[model samples]
Target: MASTHPEHLSGSTADYSVAVPKSMFPGLFVLGMVSWTLVEYLIHRFLFHMKPPSDSHYLIMLHFVMHGQHHKAPFDGSRLVFPPVPASLVIAFFYVFLRLILPEAVAGIVFAGGLLGYVFYDMTHYYLHFGSPHKGSYLYNMKAHHVKHHFEYQKSGFGISTKLWDYFFHTLIPEESHPKMQ
Candidate 1:
């Protein structure tokens, strides 16, 4: 039977009539991807890691449901990706929001780019937990940085697809300390 998941249906053909100019689409798409990296950084840092009150069981449970579980089980493959149901809702919201602020064609192209970026981020996060990348590679460095975020620097190192935001926000993990001259 055909899968009923939103992810399965997400590959439905787009309306090329609403597409941005061929030349501009690539630039706009890249801009959207870059914008997604910033959004990822902000949400991960500010929202996911926000500390709920000590006495509120409901808030604590909500925190666990949202993000604490990931920290609690960094290697859980099932929880790695945003579930398609909730993801679809967020995607729809962005689609409507973008359409409101931008031309339909431009918004579609940019939204497609942001969606692709989110896919990349989810896959990269899963791979960081499970796949072993070659040392000195980009994925290798990212995996190392992400591991530090999980285990050592929970308050920083929120960047996943890129470190640009962490650098911009001064939240990048610090290097190992070295002794200075006495």
Candidate 2:
């Protein structure tokens, strides 16, 4: 399966750090992870699910390559997580962006937290696609939500890791209807 090595991520982002005091790490880390959820939801909803111009073959192909392919073959494990190179490019972008906006120590820890959130998102996404969770559990619910998004609610239910964004954005997939039987 395509995956990012955490060691590489830590190594690359290390340059953006200067010596984050132990006291500030937890808060900065949590902030970063919280920031990531919004980013995840936004990217999934806007970019990955964007509809290209009908007349533009290039954009259409780009959409397919970026995300449609996942919907087309949901169970393809290798495609579930991004390969290291592309993932690193995006990660680096975040690191640099955060560095510009925040102190070095703060930015590094925040970036690391965001990166950890992303890893969790990827793992949760893969599990929702292929794992069996106990009925009524969080994963079970998320799996149902994700499958619905794939099969019937393409425009809603964009949150793969956590439903917090979906609830906030009001894009949640409505509850499934089941007809009553005598």
Candidate 3:
């Protein structure tokens, strides 16, 4: 059945977000955002860092194009984000999956939150590559963590937007003895 709320399909933020009770909306939004972090960590660790069999050149090249290229050229501004076409497909998959499990209005707000989380992840990934984050700040710590992952601990510290999962999964990079990255 078509949702009577045409605004649900429209890009109007207020319409879908307020579909739920005021108290429930905040928690659901945060849940969706945090869920994206889990997705990001899992995708990076399991897919992006997957080891292809040595005999299969096709898998090796595919891995390189999917993620190895980023490790090879971290500052390639052009490679900072998933290409729009591929990204849209992934986003659609998530939206459809979320809609299947949650009520229409609730799913809309949750998807909105997850979408925002994705944006933050991309921006943070780009900044960590190029920005000179202030020392002793969160971004600086994240930059140092990410730099360590790139240059040294490639097998660990998979969390890019936040290290909360790395800590939980026991894959957090060990504390650096040297001065943190500038």
Q: Listing every candidate in turn, what is its Cα RMSD in Å to the true structure after a full C-alpha superposition? A: 9.2, 9.7, 6.3
Top candidate, metric lDDT:
3
List lDDT for all candidates, in order.
0.89, 0.90, 0.92
Comparing candidate 1 with candidate 3, which one achieves the higher lDDT? 3
Point to the candidate with the largest TM-score.
3
Task: Give the alpha carbon lDDT tens digit for every residue of 112-171 in model 1.
Answer: 999899999989988999999999999999999999999999999999989999999999
Clashing pairs in 3: none
* Per-residue alpha-carbon lDDT of candidate 3 for residues 1-182, written as tens digits (9 for 90 to 100): 65767565656655544356779888888988999999999999999999999999999999999999999998899988889999999999999998888778788889998999999999999999999999999999999999999989999999999999999999999984797698
Model 1 residue runs over 4 Å out of place are 1-21, 177-182
lDDT of 2 by residue, 1-94 (tens): 5358765564566656567669989998999898999999999999999989999999999899889999999899987897889999999999
In TM-score terms, candidate 3 sits at: 0.85
Would you give me the overall lDDT of model 2? 0.90
TM-score per candidate: 0.84, 0.84, 0.85
| Candidate 1 vs 2: which has more lDDT | 2
